[model samples]
Target chain A: MQLKPGGIAATIGALAAGLVALPAAAQQQQQDAPSVAPGNAYDQSASDVDALVADSAVLYYQEDGGRVRAVEAETGLAWTGADGLAVSGRFTYDSLTGATPNGATRARYDQDFIGPLPAGGHLPAADTRTGASGAYTAPAGTLPVDPHFKDQRKAGDLGLTLPARAGFRLSLGGNASWESDYTSWSWRVGLAKDLFDKNTTLSLGYNYEHDESKPITGIPMPLGSMGDPAIGKQRIKRVDSLVLGITQVLTPAWLVQFNWSTGNSRGYHTDPYKLVTLTDRDSGDPFFYVYESRPRRRIRNSLFLASKLALGSYVTDATARWYHDSWGITAWTFGLSEHLPAGRSAYVEPLVRYYHQSKADFFRNYLLLDEPTPTYVSADSRLGAFGAWTFGLKGGVHLSDRVELYGSAQRYVQNGKRFYRDAPGTMAKVDLFAGSRSTSLVAGLRYHLR
Target chain B: MSVDRRLALLALTAGTLALAACAHDGAAPHLKLGARPWERDVLARKSMQLAVEPALLAFDDHTYFSKEAAAGGRGFDGGGCGCN
Candidate 1:
């Protein structure tokens, strides 16, 4: 072979390298460079190449007053090849059922609505009315609801992560979701680079999403009467998002991340089933209930900061966010989580989060019948001023070397303040607050296939 | 308390946290501290990650997005859910 002389030279070089230790500068460079060990071709242990890592979870959520009930099952699978290439995919299925608010506050008198929803736009066709008549009534002092709310959603995402030139890792992913009334698809690309002795990372990502809505009840013109004929059958919404993030390790036991995200959405943003009621200026009696209206464009921005601290075997994470949008909505969120060890193979985490948001510019509790309807108006409670809190506990235990099981439960409570000016006398005693209380229960198993 | 006093208190609390964060950062951001490279085994633990539970984080994001007026603080991938 031609390597006879080169082989001898390489043998001598190996001996020289073994006889003397590397210089301090060389050692530092070696420390900063990423490891490419024989056993870690995929950046993990050799056994990971032979094992399929999968995570499966099931969650149930229910809101108070039977507002909404949902169950979801999700699974994620990952594979890493010896060539340092990785592929990951996720699948999710969820079924939702129960009554949902139709955006009208409870008043002193009973309210009647048409079809399975409170909107008159959902009226059955003349030919099918005999077999599929749908209507419901809200009792006195009760919030109007759509009792026939039911839907199933299936979603999936696939991603690839691979190393790029100049010490950067690039990621490409796409996601799609389908439901009876709505569908969405998105593609995202991301780039991340490590620096400062591998103690800091900078990342940038961009995503574009397209969504379509085909309401079974038909799409009505903005602010139009409930019984008006549908303006169209389908509407489309699109969003473009960009995110910049930085992760830094202050000490061996502390890590912090800062992220700034911005997005712009155009097209449909209003809920088709929601309605707003108009009351007479003199008697406060309900005069008309019409579909809601919203602007065609929205721009949003947020700043997020999170930190994790390791104290011995215990770990704690704290996060805070500031959010704002062109719709005149501002929000703040804070969260804290602590992971404590219980035994050799088990741990528990207690978490708490707080959120508060101000009312949107066009949010109206109720429109006045005597006055002209504003260009943009909505009674959806989510657009109003509200504060929320979440408390949760999660625990996990290793059933065996290859299996881990975990479960969590969390309670969410929201409180809002509703206000209106120049209301009629009869509306004085009505409860206008719109809020919700819900509970979430989740359980999951992670298995390593060999 | 008055609004001014409350604002002052908030500022003070934030300053205190900032100092604490910098105590190990050596007066500036992203600066290495006393811990040696080999001593970072604890930081390698999964629990030490910013968001340890990915699944739980996703669920929380979805829940808050549906409940609140403003969304999109973390990940940019989210579908338009017909939720109230």
Candidate 2:
């Protein structure tokens, strides 16, 4: 199905109508169970139907200066079976287009690029060119960008939950995502048990993922050197992670959750499309660019904690996370949100989050020709020391007994750390702190179908 | 303290709290069986959930994962994307 806004609503209405009757009959037959409150059929059915929710959302994301624009549509369906089983599925389609920064600094003259060469062919050297209308200028003192960047991706997920016993739940899931240049498949298993009268829950989970990336154009020459073979090939990366979590009901109005996780990734971790500018060792003048490289293995760990408290008609949530990686990066994240209800069918939530991270050991904006090339180096800004802030607001209204509508907007900004500098006296005086900003908006409709 | 020590301390604290609760009397039935009838409606409100909306939270997490350098500390983890 197209699942456009109108189509999604119509489809949901029909599907919900068909599915609602089965669950009601099942619940009525199961009213003999002690847990089913007598004469509270609506509440019992509501609780049962609440487990099944269908969602459709459209998202728009934009970066500064008309840079990258991404539009995505996502749909999800989750239903609980009568035999202590639940299944859920999700699918998302993303279309991305626009200019993206190419790791080169602003130059005194315009820069031009040529050809998407086939495998084993080198990228044409950057140069200035003349057009019919005279010199074609790309402008100076601004970040270099590849103007013809575009891609599309489709991702799907499936999950199953089974209540194996009185107090234990088991979950299994798999995911597949495919893009023009990349494909990934992952599987996960999780188990959870309730203790202390179901107030304390402990869970463990593990996941494994395998990914293959084949750059649409071709893999650049090794070490980013010129005149090298730009082979068209597929690179692989794999990750395995484990998680342990605990949730406790502290009081009638408060609850807390904690999670500890560890993971490791191996294989190609570099940005295939990014490169580092090489500068003259002594003069600090621009020399050339080379493809970025990164370590083959990465180990990471994180601890996260979250708490929720209810006060009258308002609910508040707070979370903190600490993360560290073998790449010599450490990060801290904190967030808070407050949900306030308006009347009986509407709610508004305001959220704010702050994140700060240390740079990887091999991160560099530009490499000096005088220094020996490291085994691993990258110019990707995400690997550098930076701080990010996100502000968001979301509101939802109940449109009908089975449908709810919600929309959200979020703004994110990342600024480089002030303490970072190239080395005392480099040839170029590049400003590494030029930050990036983006905004995202999402509109969604949810259906509680029995 | 080191991260390992802190983790140990937190685990110990959680163990102690659970044991202490187990030892205590039925002084707070509301914390055990269920909430009082007067507060049931409020407790059952959809907005009271930590995630509130699961699909929306999942989408937000995916966006952050693509843009940020961190991932996975929540209850469950899976899936990989080429957003980077």
Candidate 3:
């Protein structure tokens, strides 16, 4: 039987659920053993049972944006003994100003014959065009540019887990978010199991997500016939995912892990807020309007591997990932972390990461104002190929047995290749549609009540 | 049961009895039994182990989720969201 996206997700979810229940069965069998001495056995049983109780922890965080403030709070508990279970959950609030709530748009062309022709060379008659008379007579050149829209959003999540025994554990979780114009929900479940005397662990997981958005009322519709008008009002989308993984503890001081995951998404994938121009074939004039509804589906797959090793007094962690999707996008990522002790009371960790992605299938540097084209074309930056790098340092210091303090700082930059550049032949003239650079800092303290 | 099979079983049983008789010839050791090695250290450091630092792990989760492609310390690729 062929496995659809939803089917794969469901299968993985079922596997994870089964893994979570295995530990309870093992614990039951262990409890049936006969006792040797009354007092000693009773005391040993008390300690063993007490060790299975769950441990608890809490944390708070704040994220900074130029005009937006984002915060998160989380609480977690884990049982350590026979059952070996863990559960963690978190809630987040995000607020943004000068944020573009409305989505962005993009369009592309196979080839533009923008010759250095005189202004009076050719023009199209206004009456022959369907909408927006200006589009029929406007020059073939591109528009100057417009300011991006602003918007806001808030989101939250919760996660639960059961630890590995004989090397097995189960994980499950969900998240939801809401904005002025849109709402989304996602859920996931997973199971991990170890084999070969705890040397190799395998995991399988699945996720499902749904998103919907409503257009603002009273906004005037664009004057164009290139894209579907139905997209201007309401939007709906869905995605299902599946993941599989393997981990190996090669040695006492070395570990390696590998993972592969796939996702299939369907429905409205284009942003409604952006617009594209079409060019008249005969007159070279351009048309100005919005390209709205386009139904599309995507398939994404990824491979990731990471390793950790102890180097003298410090530990080093390294990871690499490769990703590809049906949208004609491919990407790679590399990251590293090093931890060093800062005297007896403190420790420091420095981290660096780099990422790069290729452009989407329909990505275009620019679109003409007046043009008639096929159904598929987009310029969304999220679909485009891009590269980014981030560097950060984190440190922690112990004040006493009950209290500790820690903090981190990070800087990020997006490479120019992420944007389009003018090239020869079939190479379209592309430019940076938009880009951002920022830094983040966090600090917090932990207190033990027990 | 066959005669030979019964005789083999009886001989095995007799040998087990002989071993048991020899074991009873010795008395239990006089030295006192104590806590397991790991248990002793755990009890000695009891005061330092009680604090649950939930927040620190939460911060690590968020940071790693947004920045790293491979997560789950044990080697799994996490889902990609709009958080980054």
Best by lDDT: 1
Candidate achieving higher lDDT, 1 or 3: 1
DockQ versus reference, model 3: 0.03
Report how closely model 2 matches the true complex, as a DockQ value: 0.33
lDDT of every predicted structure (CA atoms): 0.73, 0.69, 0.47
DockQ head-to-head 1 vs 2, winner: 2
Candidate 2 chain A: worst 10 consecutive residues by lDDT? Answer: A127-136
DockQ of each: 0.25, 0.33, 0.03
Tens digit of per-residue lDDT, candidate 3, span A1-450 = 112446434534543443333334223323543222221111112122113222222222222233222333333333334455544445544433222211122223321211111123343222211111112111122222221222344556677676555566788888887665567788888988755444455678888888775533211233234322232446667888777666655444555666666777787555544444444333333333444333368776677777766544465778788777676777887888776654444556688988777876666533554345546665444455567787887655445434445555567665545233333222233233433355555555444443
> Model 3, which residues run further than 4 Å from truth?
A1-82, A99-152, A163-167, A217-233, A277-289, A292-295, A369-371, A417-433, A447-450, B1-84
**How does residue A144 of candidate 3 score in lDDT?**
22
Chain B TM-score, structure 1: 0.50
Question: Which is superior by lDDT, 2 or 3?
Answer: 2
* CAPRI quality level assigned to candidate 3 from its DockQ score: incorrect
C-alpha lDDT of candidate 1 relative to the true structure: 0.73
Which 10 successive residues of model 1 chain A have the least lDDT summed?
A38-47
The candidate that wins on DockQ is: 2
Q: Candidate 1, residues A214-309: lDDT per residue as tens digits?
A: 777668778987667777778989999988787777788888887778888999988987888887778776777888999999888787889888
